[model samples]
Target: MAVRPILIFPDRHLSQPARTVQYFGPKLDTLIQDLMDTLRSTPGVGLAAPQIGVMERVSVIDFSRMKKKLKPAPCQDVRVLINPILLSGSGIQVPREGCLSIPDLLANVRRYEEVRVRIQDQMGAELILTASGFEALALQHEMDHLDGKLFIDRVLNLKTDVFRRKT
Candidate 1:
């Protein structure tokens, strides 16, 4: 497994919808590992295949770091979602969000406070995940990438809702 380069904003791949993973093979395994490596190397909660220039329907998320800070951690798990599809969503939470692909910019992008998603895991087993709070937001954020969307795309106003992060 290797840490792949994360495609930045303006990269056409980031704007293009990824192809569904039709086969669970070595290539798929590599993609999953590479994504995990990239996420661990970078400062982010999740990563999608397209963000690494791979237009495949794959994403990796590790919420442990972000969860540990909370009084009751949401979940300490690393997840891989392949061909992810949102089954249902409810509520709304516009927590400030940022993306590794977008660098230092942070924005308030409204996301489902709770969501149920169906996706294939690293081993190709299909499962449904119901999550709320930060975990829900993270899932939605990564799922957006499969549809070629970014956190910035959902920001209502660049002047007010978006701002550069303090170094």
Candidate 2:
């Protein structure tokens, strides 16, 4: 497992839709492990394959620890989702979001307040989950990468919703 460098914004690879994982082999496992390591190293809640320059439909999320501190919900272990598919999410809410790819830029983007998602783990076991609030937002944000969408694409207003890097 290694920490892969996250691809920054404006990269062409980030704009292209990711390919699905055809085989759940050792290479996929290595990718998953690398993603987990990279996500944890950044101390981030979620990460997508495109972020690490892999054009595959893979993502890992660890909102358990963060959610526990922010809410009173029961927390679970870290979750790694590969080829995640968003099923549904009800009600839209604009949240201020930041991206590792975008660096210091932050923006307000519209997202669902809650969501239901289906995904497979690193071992190819299927799991479906319902998430709300920040967790929901994070999942939506990461999943967007599969379709080549970024927080910047969802920015409510470039003049106001998007912010510049702080030096």
Candidate 3:
């Protein structure tokens, strides 16, 4: 597995909904590894397949790194969610976020404070889990890419809600 180039904003490929991952094999394992590597190589908490120019409904999330950027988080494992479906979401939080893809800016995106998702692991086994707070927010944000959506698309008001990173 390798660290692939993450697609930047306005790239048409980022705007297209990802196709379902119908087959699982060595290729799928490689995808998970690449995504995990890409995410680790950055400060971001999650990375989706489409973010790497792969149009597949798969994503990797590792909350460990966010312990320094955000608040102390409970989900520390590097997780791979294939064909993930958000089963339920509760509460709401508008967190200021930055994207590895849209590297130059930050934005306030509305995300669920808690969420439950049905997803498949690399072995193609189905599993469901609940997440709250930062983990929940990260999951929601990544899932949007699977639908060809971005945090900007969910911004309540671009004029006031959008922000640029100070760095």
TM-scores for the candidates: 0.94, 0.90, 0.93
* RMSD (Å) per prediction: 1.7, 2.0, 1.7
> For model 1, how does the per-residue alpha-carbon lDDT over 1-167 read when each residue is reduced to its tens digit?
89988889989999999998988999898888899888999878899999989999998888785743323444458888899899999998888888999988999999888889998877788988888878888889999999999999999998999989888
**How many clashing residue pairs are found in candidate 2?**
0
Candidate 3: where is the Cα deviation over 4 Å? 68-76
- How would you encode candidate 2's per-residue C-alpha lDDT over 1-167 as one tens digit per residue? 89999888898878889998778889998988998899888857888898888899998878764633433433255777777888998988787788778888888899998889988876788889888777778789988988899999987679989987676
Summarize candidate 3's per-residue lDDT along 1-167 as a digit string, tens digits: 69998899999878899999999999898989999888888888889999999999999988776654444455557888899999999998888877788888888888888889999988889989788878888888888989999888888898999988888
Native-referenced Cα lDDT, model 2 = 0.82
Q: 2 or 3: which has the higher lDDT?
A: 3
Kindly give the number of clashing pairs for every candidate.
0, 0, 0
- Provide the clash count, candidate 3: 0
Q: What ranking of all candidate models by lDDT puts the best one first?
A: 1, 3, 2
Q: Go through the candidates in order and give each one's C-alpha lDDT.
A: 0.87, 0.82, 0.86
Candidate 1: segments with Cα more than 4 A from true spot: 67-76
